[model samples]
Target: MQEEEPRGWRPAVAALPAAAAALVYAWARWCFGGAAPPSPAVAVAGGAVLVLGASAAYALSVRGAGGLFGALFLALGLLSTVAATERTAARAETATCVVREVHAETEASFGEGGAEKTVYRLALDCPGGRPGELKDAPSPLSRGAEVRIAYDPRGRLSAVPAGAARPWKPALSALLLLALAAVLAAHRRRPQP
Candidate 1:
């Protein structure tokens, strides 16, 4: 017997949550500009909504939806956490870094507040002048120019020019993405009936 396609509006349903999330993010970034912090309860509520919506959408569709969602969420969450942490570290202090080299020009993309960010790469020399320091720094810099690089010691390649980013926002966003990916991955690997 031929296997039947699961056609209960799964793809469209699944897309709703993701699309909502994308819209919410875009609104936050464009209108708010990270000027205020969200209340914990509100943040939690929003997260719950996103999770449920996405899950419902996926469940209505095919068996593979879970795995794909998981990976997508995981990647995004991790990125948000890193960005938020970096913003906080750079808020107050200024650390001098020499522009070691500009990494080859690549089209860098990021979501800020919710809108997309277009960025270019610049390799910076750390305080102690460590060689091979061409790790990805988020901000654009000219080769040999000095800049104040603010970053979390625990998160490499998660820094920005001290004055450039809004602390906490990006991090929170990245965390959400990472968490979603993890949860989806977990669910996908489970034994199903």
Candidate 2:
């Protein structure tokens, strides 16, 4: 049975966009280079848990529903936060490393942009193979060419080009998420249309 509460809440729908984005990002990561490797069973299990948790929240809006939603929000929030931090660190850790490999990587366009842009995949040897540790990379990187790689000491392999960090990216993303959440919470207070 639906929980008795104010009618204007649509937090569930509000989360859909981010969830969808995450799903797409995950798919892209999994499908990188056409040599997609099987995700560990644990990842599937975790995804299942998230789904079940959301469903359970929808089903039982009693006392714990808010908590469940909060948990979900935290989960998504932390993921973005971590990614942002990792990227920042990676950029700061940029070091002069030889590009062991470079390959063309194609990514699908988002929104209505029905266009494809070419990107490159670079392999840099870091102190350790820590991922998600780069923010911006210097320009003109090529295979066998020495290029500056910014990476987090914690993550080395996930380093990208030096200028990849756009201050607006995370700022805009967080603002939108908060705005949507606020709108949904407000809607939840209104009678369901």
Candidate 3:
């Protein structure tokens, strides 16, 4: 005999993939945004963990009835990539600004210690006087030096050196979304009981 299902469980179940995807996205952003270690081993480990976590989430959600959880997670990933790519195209302007400050950056060195690697950031005078920072700042950059950078007026993200191409994120995301759509369509065309 089949036991009756509990009340109000499906909604939470449906949200699992979304929550997992969000966590993965945040982790990835942190890794690429220079807070995490920049070593190849660290990057590979992070990528492996993300894949395994997403797979686990899909398995838990799809074991019930519909197999749509995979598509939902994939869609969320694609959306994030698209959003990042959009900033490169819209409201980005090239301008020369005075370097107001220079900051030395490094990964969070916890228990492990041997040597420290350093990166640089240059703060610039933006339109509204709020100031924007440029990551991967050149070694020669110094306060009061004129530097050209690409900045978004809205300041959703930090500035970058001018003439950077951001094509990989959206391209990879589009490919994944297209593949998922094709697979879903094929699955739906099969006959049901």
Candidate whose lDDT is highest:
3
Best by TM-score: 2
- Over 1-193, each residue of candidate 3 has an lDDT whose tens digit, in order, gives 4544355445554454445556555555554444333465675577667656655555454442234545554555545543454434443567788888899887565566855667888878865654477787756587898877776565545566776646577656645653553344333322232
C-alpha-based local distance difference test score of model 1: 0.51
Q: Please report, in order, the local distance difference test score of every candidate based on alpha carbons.
A: 0.51, 0.47, 0.57
Model 3 clashing-pair count: 0
Each model's TM-score, in the order given? Answer: 0.35, 0.48, 0.45
- List candidate 1 segments past 4 Å from native: 1-54, 57-94, 104-119, 129-140, 167-193
TM-score of 2: 0.48
Q: Write the per-residue lDDT of candidate 2 for residues 1-193, one digit (tens) a residue.
A: 4446433345554554355445534533442212433454644465455544543443343224443454454345434533443334323555666666665656688869678756666666655554322223333366667655544453223566556654456545644653443344334432233
Q: For each predicted model, how many residue pairs clash, with residues at least 3 apart or on different chains?
A: 16, 28, 0
RMSD in Å for all candidates: 12.5, 9.5, 12.0
